[model samples]
Target: MLNFKNIAIRRGNRLLFSKASFIIHKGQKIGLTGANGVGKSSFFALLRGELHSDEGEFSMPPNLEIAHVAQETPALDCTAIDYVLDGDRELRQLQQQLAAAEQAQDGLKQAELHGNLDHIGGYTAQARASRLLNGLGFSTAQEIHPVSSFSGGWRMRLNLAQALMCRSDVLLLDEPTNHLDLDAVIWLQDWLGRYPGTLLLISHDRDFLDAITDHIVHIEQNNAEIYTGNYSDFERMRAEKLSQQQSAFEKQQREIAHIQSFVDRFKAKASKAKQAQSRIKSLERMEIIAQAHVDSPFNFRFPAPKKLPNPLLKIEDADIGYGDKVVIKNASLSITPGDRIGLLGPNGAGKSSLIKVLSGQMRQLNGELHSAESLNIGYFAQHQLEQLRLDESPLWHLQKLDKQASEKDLRNFLGGFDFRGDKVNDPIGPFSGGEKARLVLALLVYQNPNLLLLDEPTNHLDLEMRHALSVALQEYEGALVVVSHDRHLLRSVTDQLLLVANGKLQVFDGDLDDYRLWLAENKKTGDEPAPAAIASPAVRKDERKLEAKRRNTLKPFMDAVKKSEALVDKLQQQQIELESKLADPSLYQEENKESLKTLLAEKSRIDNALHQAEDNWMVAEENLQQAEKSCIN
Candidate 1:
């Protein structure tokens, strides 16, 4: 368990968080969310002790371990199996120490070895290692591949595998689902749902989070507020909280207005002046909550354009692959102007490569990619930041793209991405992935090209920022081609879908989720689809109602689980303090006898409460399982 107390983060002169307090507990999954550059990742780092805040304290059990997974690690060199197996460092160390002792035939060390082996559950480490490796997206075949040979996305899978293999007390994941395919993501969600350790993950995948996290921590205007539930529940709670705040603010405003009216009328009467003044003083003393408005990062719309004569863009009999290994083969699709298109595909299905070919960054090997005349294109590549010059400042980078732009114009554009003043002057080198993506997007908005291509542009962005981008794209009068695994994003901003799978492009005229379901069907072994397989309308409605009922029934249990999570935090804190005192030999001395007794007593009480809470948590979980089963059948 860990607690972040009174923490503050700054980007240049701007404060990201101030005196924010939050706690993470064992077996709880917490989601950190906010707009881009609002310091969610920074907060994660602060909790992990990777980044220090300018003020306040972070407390955790001294022995509590944390594992953080990045999108990719450039330094990885071992095979994926080695990377995953390396997570069992403690087991490996113990084995080495035991082997050394055995070689020396030291009886005292042998007893220590047996005790350590028994404590670590050494007999089960290997089985756990394999099971975790599979759960986190690594197949047995791929595990033997050298990490260097893997793509950035696959390398990310290795990071996930490693983290799960470690089975640390807490997982501090930054965009853990960024590279995962739907199956892998679902597997991960299920794994986390059943996991006993604590999890704190930042992800843009809505369905994944909706299925997993038990708590949501929203960081807004330099503070954090905790909510209980999944992403959807968090959104509902956020709206309710904001609405409540607005109601309170309105009441305060009305009271102040009434008092002001009374003061204005009674000022001439000397006797009523003191009462009016006291009312005025009361009005002035009322501290209203600031307007908690969330303006997403990108929020611009393009002027509507005339419909295209035919398709805005087209691909004909294309083969997308490296060399002879074709992924998308003989694919053809037409995109109309002003169409919001979602590109769906599994990993290694050539989604990005196809987008690249369509956008003219890469040419097709065997087919023609045709486009309308006078077409202007804007592409948000996966490595859009790589296009930026490292030596240049944020403003300078913007200027590099358009040297004719004035400083005033450039600064205003950067401001849209939440960069301002000295932040605009900050070199590109230190900016986080979200910042870099926003910078690239800011330039794109200014350009306002007719054809926009986006490739997983939402991964690094937080909920608010992604919503902003979605709003902007939704309003844009252009042909959009977005390749992303984010289900919510696709649903929000896309009109239809162009699915790439089995070396082909299959266009679907429906919602993105429907298209996703279609893709899922294509991958399934069953001859009949779920929709077609259901015999009666009663069964279909019952199934739908069942799912809804299960999700609803879990909400109250989640709330109770959240309360127990708080208790766990307090118990962990008490445990840490007790351990610190116990570590000191002076506590056993007669002079410190009373202190020892008190500490021990407090520890015992805390331990008992923690035990009870854990039991309650188990019961809540069992209840949820029963509810889910009932909903299913």
Candidate 2:
């Protein structure tokens, strides 16, 4: 167990926490939460022994193995799986020792080392690492890819995979789901739930916290308090406390006022002097209850558009992609005023590409895009944050949008986003990602566009800001198309779900929960985009005739493939049962000779059947592959 006893922690001269005591028992999954700068990360640092408490004690087992995701991944030529395998230092050491022992002709030592390797699952380490990679959304083909080949966000996932690869006693994850897509996030939530170690997670995603954590350690007002339930529970508990606090504060004010009135009226009279003195003494001894303040820093909203246009933007038979490459083809969509559409799909399935097409950032390779005569678009993408004028202040940025607006008015608007005083006029170069996001949102809102295209808008936003954005978006009069990993934001703001997959745009029939089920089913079948049946309008008749002919020709081969898959699955299950029986040591006892023989015979028979089944499946798969190739040709 980890214990913090009357601990006071300080960063620089600021006392972040004083007399904070909390016990994190073994195997307890706790979600650490607070506002952006309330020292949640510092508490993690303290746990890692990188920082000591300013006073009091912080204690845990000295031999405990703690694992955490690396903040930065160094670019290397190593394979991703090998990078993950490196997380198991003991396994690497054992392998190295065994190799050296074999080279030295130390037969006894080599045998001992091999036994140790088996004991530690060294042989299956690569398979375990591969599973971790697969669960994190890396394909089998990408597992062997060089670490440096992946983007920054992918590298962060790799780091998280590496951290999880360790055999740890305690795990510390800070915003582990920030870079992940919805599917990956779900996979990770399941994985962490099954972990056998103590977990301390720091995330702004409330849905994620609610799913994995059983306890919440909330840091607020320079104090860390432990709540006995998940994030939702903590919110409920805090809300009740705040409500009671408000009531108590009002009653206290009335009591103090009444006491003062009595003291003023009777202090000059001898008969009431003692009573007034007693009231004054009681007032001095009483504790003042402060009122609850739960105001969100964000108060801005999407102002009404200048012109309401029906069908604000339309894409007809569009193919969206980068130059010379098609990511999504045969796509079509219509955005009308007040339409709230949320795009959902697996990572790299062109959600962002479709957004770009709608926003007119990318020119379609084919078909046409139609926009209303009075169309106004406000687009927000992650890359657009880099496009901001770093040297300009928030006030200056807003002034550039409307030069006639007064500085006081601009400042007041910026204050709604928590950019007050000098922050409004200072260069935004030093601003954090969240601040930059807020500024971009502010700019987007100020534009009063009739159409909004947002991609991962809540990436760096806090829960309060996300809540504010959701509330604002719900009241927005303009059309919206948002692609986000935040499920709460998606569920709260969007009314329609559009699936961007298989190079086609289609309306999803169900909600976010259904989308998760769809993801699981697709992943089980190794179906990435579900193979779009795309054809141009000009070739519709011809394409239908060709498709019918191809289907007729491929039916037999497809049937054969399905039959073989079923046979393989059945044989595999029988083999697993046979193996389970053979694993029983009692079958080899003196009185069980007949049973032993029977089990061994059955195991051998099942093994032969499995081999034959696999062979047939391979042959059938080869025939299908050839048929597909011929049909394509």
Candidate 3:
């Protein structure tokens, strides 16, 4: 058990927590919730002794061992496994001590050493480490990879895994899922739900915290209060509290107003003056209920377009995907002006590939794809960094985009994307993934393209950022094509859906979730049901026409898919040529080094083209497979 008594914490001169107290017993999972900048992380740090409260007594079971995995990892350079293995410091030390003793004048010491090992449970360290690695999505092979070779997100995972391996009595985690993909996040949720130790997780992921935690401790207005139950439960409880507060406030307002009316009417009279004055004094002395900013502000707005699209892009029997693996085969899809199409599916569902095909950076096989005249596309690259130089500062980035653009413009634009004053000059190399994602969006917005092509736009943003982007995208008027798995984001910003399922591009006449559910119902194997009646009346007239189009375009489409496959083959050959040149270090050692530079440049270009081709190929394959699946096996 742990108890925080009269705990007070301040940020600079601002008091974050003043004389707050809370208690946690073993086997409890607590969620910390508040608005952004409510000092949730600070409170967690205080419990871990990472930060000292100005006035407080935090008492735990005496000398209790605690481990804190911060939201952002500390800089560490070592193999993933070695770092985890270091968690068993005591066990390693004991084993080394036993080995030294055995060498120091006695063979019988080996027998005695086993007893020491048993006492420390030294036999389980390796097993424990191995389990942790696998649980955290690391294999024996990954464990051996240099930590420096990993990205910042992966490094953070390693740090988290290390903390878990230490078997701390109490665990404090801040935004544990910030670096994790959805699958990894769910896995962590399950593990933490069953964890035996005292757990405190600070996060804004409502579903994540609600599913795993049993208690919610909220920090609001420099004060702390513990509520029994999950985040969802706390929300319900908090609502009730606020409602009650509102009632009291309303009652007080009525009482005060009634008194004021009486006072106003009777102040000039002699007898009633004393009573009205006393009422006024009572009203003045009463402390008002604090107006908590409990309601999250989701006032998202989309910018209305200056003009609508006449027609954005046209595709007829287009085969789009990566080199050799076509994803959308024999698919004819069109984008009109003012169409907000949500592209959605599972991870690796080829949504991004389809966007690339529409963008014209990629050519479709067996089909003539064309964009309308004077098309302006704002593409948010899924991999990002297409426009970013790792070595360049944010200001340098702006300069590269527009030489004539001033520093003031750069700061304002970057600031709009959540990058601030000094951060606008910071090197892109050290920026967080979320920061980079926002930067990409910022760049796109500044360009003011009529056609906005966003691929997984909400990947790294926090909830606040996600809401902000969703609001902005909602108001964007030009043809908007988005690829995302965020249901909330998709639901808010899009009404039409272009679903790339299996190998076919489906123009769903409804929203994303509806499309998903429709697919599940219709596409389930061995349970073919009659087609559901169409609820969306917009596409009713085109149902048969669309079916005919799907049928008529398929043959030429398949041919186009084949041609796209051929393109992938050519790109692969180009990759092979580049790889062969890169393999020879002697090529660079020679005189001009011009050939080497050219090869490197060629390789980079080919690699990018190949990536696009591969995406196209996927669509083709998916289309082919879907066609085959629609028929008998």
lDDT of 2 by residue, 104-126 (tens): 96544654565566566665576
Give model 3's TM-score versus the native structure. Answer: 0.56
TM-score of each: 0.66, 0.79, 0.56
lDDT tens readout by residue for model 1, 130-187: 5666555454455556778887777778778777777588888777876776546655
In terms of lDDT, the poorest run of 10 residues in model 2 is 284-293
Which pairs of residues clash in candidate 2, taking residues 3 or more apart in a chain or in different chains? Answer: none
Tens digit of per-residue lDDT, candidate 3, span 1-633? 978889888899988877788888887999887755678878877777778879878877776668776355545677777677666556667678767965783323533554555555554465467567655656445666777777776878887887777657788888777656443554577678877888888775656776889998888778888999976577566655665676645644554464355335433542332223443343232222111222333222334445555677888887776777766677776788767677754334467677777776677766877787767888887467545777777767777779898888667666666667787777788776667776777767766778888876776566556655754664566888886545455555555655565566665444433444554564333122223333356665565566555555456556756787698779766665555455554664657378766765776698699778866765765665466445311
Whichever of 2 and 3 has more lDDT, that candidate is 2
Which residue runs does candidate 3 get wrong by more than 4 Å? 70-78, 88-140, 241-298, 305-633
lDDT of 1: 0.67
- In candidate 2, residue 413 scores what lDDT? 91
Q: Return the top candidate by lDDT.
A: 2
User: Which of candidates 1 and 3 reaches a greater lDDT?
Assistant: 1
